[model samples]
Target: MEDLAQMTLDLTDRRLLSELQRKGRIFNSDLAEKVNLSASACHRRVQRLEAEGYINEYVALLDARKMGVPATIFVEITLSTQADEVLEAFEKAVQRIPDVLECHLTAGAADYILKVVAEDTEDFARIHRQYLTRLPGVAKMQSSFALRTVFKTTALPV
Candidate 1:
């Protein structure tokens, strides 16, 4: 396997990635045509990209409202301590909560920021009571609910 750090993308590879980012389910032949490569060659490049960890797993982006989870909350968490063990314990505990879609450690007033989803405000209350409050070393937690999502995308610019 090629080292990811040493892997440089050429023009053709960039084209291939751009097409794939737009439509992950596009046919190999179609992708090849778009990138001006043979089907086999395109497939090989895709495989190599995956093997080199350039492309992670592909997933279907679901509609939260349709999936019965419409509420989106961003929670800022301040830990009681910045100790390694406290951070580790908090991260491990937060991972067990299914409602938490993303958690990021930040350098600001808050130690961590969490993106969470729920069916509604009532459900969010339950999640807060059941999970958020139970996280270890939590000194403070402030939550902001998103009224609407202006724009969201999973595709990364190549």
Candidate 2:
């Protein structure tokens, strides 16, 4: 019963989201037309979705390679200890580094996962030394460079 309800909600949300994903800069009237909803109804639905924490934020996706951040790296970090103070300190420090765009506390072989972008190898090296390696509680670090992004989508496959 719950699954069916979820599916129904997901279907409607996906229809709305797919339209927005294709054109963030598009007007709400156009969006309503595409989604087959009255403008006011569509507006209310979008507002409700935002209020309920479904639509986090609309962002302008950048062309990273053209923007000088030609290198994309996934960094795996293992901390020395899982003490609250150590974890909080490490998290706070990582947030200060602009290159560390995304960070996730993990459950597998690694403690944290970082999505980092840098101008070049030298820039990444400097970030590694000054930011990641020196971060409190850091015991081990590994990085995976992205050769290409085959698919990156903000819209959920609802």
- Candidate 2 residue lDDT tens string, 1-158: 54344323555567887877777778889888887889998898888777666677888998888889989999999998999999999999999999888999999999999999999889999999888888999889999988888888776666
Q: lDDT of model 2 at residue 4?
A: 45
Which prediction has the highest lDDT against the true structure?
A: 1
Clash count per candidate: 0, 0
User: Over the stretch 18-69, how does candidate 1's per-residue lDDT look in tens digits?
Assistant: 8888888999999999989999999999998888778887777888999999
Q: Which segments of candidate 1 are over 4 A away from where they belong?
A: 1-4
Pull out the clashing pairs in model 1. none
TM-score of 2: 0.88
Candidate 2 minimal-lDDT segment of 10 residues: 1-10
Off by over 4 Å in 2: 1-10
lDDT, model 1, position 79: 100
Q: Any idea what lDDT model 1 has?
A: 0.93
